[model samples]
Target: MSMSVPVVGNFRQVPEVAQAGCRITERPENDLTDYAQLLDVIDVGICAVDRTLCIRSWNAFMAAHSGYGSREVIGRPLFELFPELPQDWLKERFDRVFDLGVPSFTSWEQRRYLFSFPHNCPINGGVESMQQDTRLLPIKDELGRVVQVLVCLFDVTDAVLLHHRLAETIQVLEEERQEQQQLIARLAETQEQLIQSEKLAAIGQLAAGVAHEINNPVGFVMSNFRSLEHYVEGAFTLIELFDRHIDVLPAEARAQVARLKQDMDYEFVANDVRALVAESRDGLERVKRIVSDLRDFSRVGETDWQWANVHACLDSTLNVVMNEIKYKAKVVKAYGDLPEIECMPFQLNQVFLNLLVNAAQSIRERGTITLRTRTEDDHVCIEIEDTGAGMTPEVMKRIFDPFYTTKPVGKGTGLGLSVTQSIIGRHQGSISVASTPGLGTTFTLQLPQRHTTAM
Candidate 1:
């Protein structure tokens, strides 16, 4: 018969062995050690099937893992013991592996085929009750004809579960990092907006002071012009009478009356008449220019972009704040030749206004504020320097934070430098400051020469 004795010498110790292939070798001595004892052993299940898919070899590990004994599984169609598996499909692959001398496998797909637990295998029962990795390996006969199929199994549920858990944790951390970045960006923008609002508030307060200051000087100058107009009418009347009476007078009297008069008392009445007209006209013109500049500088959020003259904006802001600096500080300007830069004119005007005011305020008294500008290859450089009480490192570090004030509660909101930095950065430019506590401070702003976006 083709059936043969087990290869292991101590055969009785093993639960079962599958005779999947034709055994062709001559029998060895009974005293020789056999295959089962020579190999490591486990309690997990194993099985073998013939060409018709009937169970052949059933090992102790298979019996223990499957909770099925050899007696119940052997000689039975393998599918009858585990109906949960795709029986016909598994059978086809198994058949093909043997036919093609290839191997086949299955797992996870069928959790419970015979029993729920390996420990549940019947005593003489096999270990086929646990989670499994079943395979079909081809066996060849001496003539190379296919003979049987071998199947093996393992318990991998724990490993599969751990892999899934690790994947989930990684996903959670990445999501958190992204959220934090977005939050940081949002917080920075909000802080910048708040700083700008405070600066605008300070400007409003300064504007009130400016209005009060200008009104007094303006009222008198305007009155002076009005008075001078009436005086001109009187002077003209006197001249007409002199002209009419001139012909009757001799040549000597006419020459004296007609001679050109100097304002420094060459001819008193004529000089007084000329001086009043000239001074009043000049005063009115000066007042008109100052008012126009104030309006330009204070105009709010101009969204439209234009080729704007930054120099003109600076001139306007400086004029508006002239009264503030005039008494305490002297402004020294080193304006350079420049091209018209494109931007939101009114917004840039606000920037200039902030910078100039800061420069003026930096000085305690009787100091100099230097305003300078230059153009490099692709950028415009503006430097504002003041000889005033400069900053310490501690103050500079906290200067950009909102509401961090160094000035006493009313005089400063401490938002000016922060706002200046934000505006410059928004324009794709950079701003930096250098200071020495007792010497002075310099704020340098660098802007791109050409902007792609319309400000």
Candidate 2:
């Protein structure tokens, strides 16, 4: 009933077995040849062994690969020929096969135990290794006995190597993607700075001319006030003399003077003169402030950082650019209270200055420029909204590229937005512009209220 033929034989009789001698039970008298032929055709390495652990059906595929022949290996103890098949493992399962006869299986790939066959797996250049996918199954006999165990092995080096390569490739791609993202962020910030700088330069040129024009009117008014003050002082002195000498005049003359004084309301004149002088002084002060702001606005100097009163800078900038906005643009200020920021104040000044002017410029003759500010987290936000010509989406996309002027060739440096962005970058801030063709454009600046130390 045993599916495995016993390994008993006189090697001299069967030429195939005789060529190599074995030392176990006799081979099956019937079907011995058929078993030998079947071993050659199975795809994987296959071998059969009896309950005694003797090689029973040695296939050409298994025998040829293992350097063992039918007669020489068949009668040998399984451990003698292949120690990779441990004695405990071989006997334990083989005893089960001989006793209860239950079939069993194994999918141990390239795992080494104390077995002759496991060690027999060849390694070129003196380094040992094994096929990665191997399985073993038992063959049952008619009496419900596992008479033989069939072992199969497969090579799986390709799959394992491929997995490692794929993981490495993915890691490299992730690094590249992160680097690309950083590059884009830096590019955007740089473009913003360039555009802002250009805008400031343009406005600075314009402010210089306007400040001069305003200062002239202020000069004449100041001179007129001084002259008026001198003449008014003389008038006061004469009135005082009359007041002092009135008792000495005749009653008639004194009475006449009294009537004149009552008609003139001398007390009112004295009180009103002081008020007029105060008002005039205040007016002159306003003129002086305007002149001073204009000077600050026209700060065409080296680019560097400074602690600046952002509000003051913006006020002066607005005043100097007033000529550009006075008649056509309705200006609104929604400013917030904030501590002065540490920055390239001149450059930042130029940035906002340009933004305000640009907002005003965006509008056609007679529009609006709304300037608003708020504290945005740790930074300040300045929003400049304009009722201007606006722009199409396509134009907006390339607006920050150098030489991308929307204004006429002679008019714009095309770097206004780019420069603004760069200034923001140096301060670790951000700027964004949004617009609708017919509606208007809004430029927003989110600036860090304080300077940051480099890590």
Candidate 3:
């Protein structure tokens, strides 16, 4: 005989089970009993509740975890058997499933567990109870009217635990990546500083050598010029005395002397000789001053910190770079009374040179570079202002970054401002720039009157 059996979400007819040790070719009449036996051995937690919330069916997985046999839970109200379950919430879910004849799902992420079963696995020690993902499946009869709701529970404790571990691992890796980026930035700054120091040292040596070579010839030239001036004065005095006594000479002799004087342009020659001597002397003095300025600006072997006149430093550096600026822009120095400050003079000179050259180069045509210096409290403030092709906001933001420049390639190394900033920092000072596109730029420097340990 064939019989009907209710299994999970569907109803089916099947042949009944045969008696043990007997082979029967025809169908038996106990199919529902066979279906019930099949449901008991399944691994998942399977249960069905009716419209009144009474348990209609329970499987072995449910009995094993809840410690309640099928006979104990079957026919009992589901809430009565497990008082820990959220009664109103679960009832609402069941009502929705029954009314809609549809399925609903809940995962471990939203709601951890439904049944409150103890964790069965030994390795997931971090979790105290089993995590579950549940499905509410509606069951209907022949007319397609919803009768009961089947609840299927899946054990997802391991997946949830693994997810937590993976999140922690990712957090640690992200922190490490940020640390490495910071380290790389510091290393690049150190490398740029080293390169700038080497270049400054080489330039200082060359300046010192040139100054020494020029000083000797300039000294002797000035001395000989002074003696030549005296000799010319005596000769002109004797010529004046002879002119006063010219009436004492014979007629022929006097005529010969007159012809010689006219031919030689004697008065013009004497006057031009004195003027030429004055001009040559002035030129030599300028050469001598340039050599002296070069020596002061470089201070090659004077790397040790010492008390230096700030005005003197600026003047020497300005002279050293005069050729670069004289044609491009007019420099106006507004000096203020400032006390000597302790510093590495050569390094400070480099800073001045860099800023001045940059100010001059910024001007496309003739412009003004005004240098103003003054003492304010314990600091010396210097401003190098230029009426030049100023920078945009974007360019100003990155002007101090190493190898960042707007100058044409091959004309600039882009490290000038970067190295300039570094030098100022080494003296425990600060440098800042203010620029307006198409207007001009001003670089302001503040140096402490007293030296302190550099950062």
lDDT for each candidate structure: 0.68, 0.68, 0.82
Worst 10-residue lDDT window for candidate 1 reads 9-18
Best of the candidates, lDDT: 3
Model 1: lDDT of residue 449:
66
Assess candidate 1 and give its TM-score to the true structure.
Answer: 0.48
Model 1 global lDDT (CA atoms, 0 to 1): 0.68
Clashes per candidate (backbone, < 3 Å) = 26, 40, 1
lDDT (0-100) at residue 407 of candidate 1? 77
Model 3: lDDT of residue 381: 95
- Assess candidate 2 and give its TM-score to the true structure: 0.44
Tens-place lDDT per residue, model 3, 338-379, is 999988887788788989899999999899999999999999
Residues 1-455, model 1: lDDT tens digits: 24332244333222222243323244344645443432226544556678888887676666655567777887998887877667667767887877787777666654433334543432322234444556566665546566776665666545444444666787898899899988997798677766667666577557556755786778787787778787888877887797778899888876765664333454676667678677767877778678666656545344566777778877877887888888878889999987887666666767777777777777887799998999988888888899999999998888776567777888876666666666676677888889999899988878776667643
Summing lDDT over every window of 10 consecutive residues in candidate 2, give the lowest-scoring window: 16-25
For each candidate, give its TM-score against the true structure.
Answer: 0.48, 0.44, 0.62
Minimal lDDT window, size 10, model 3:
15-24
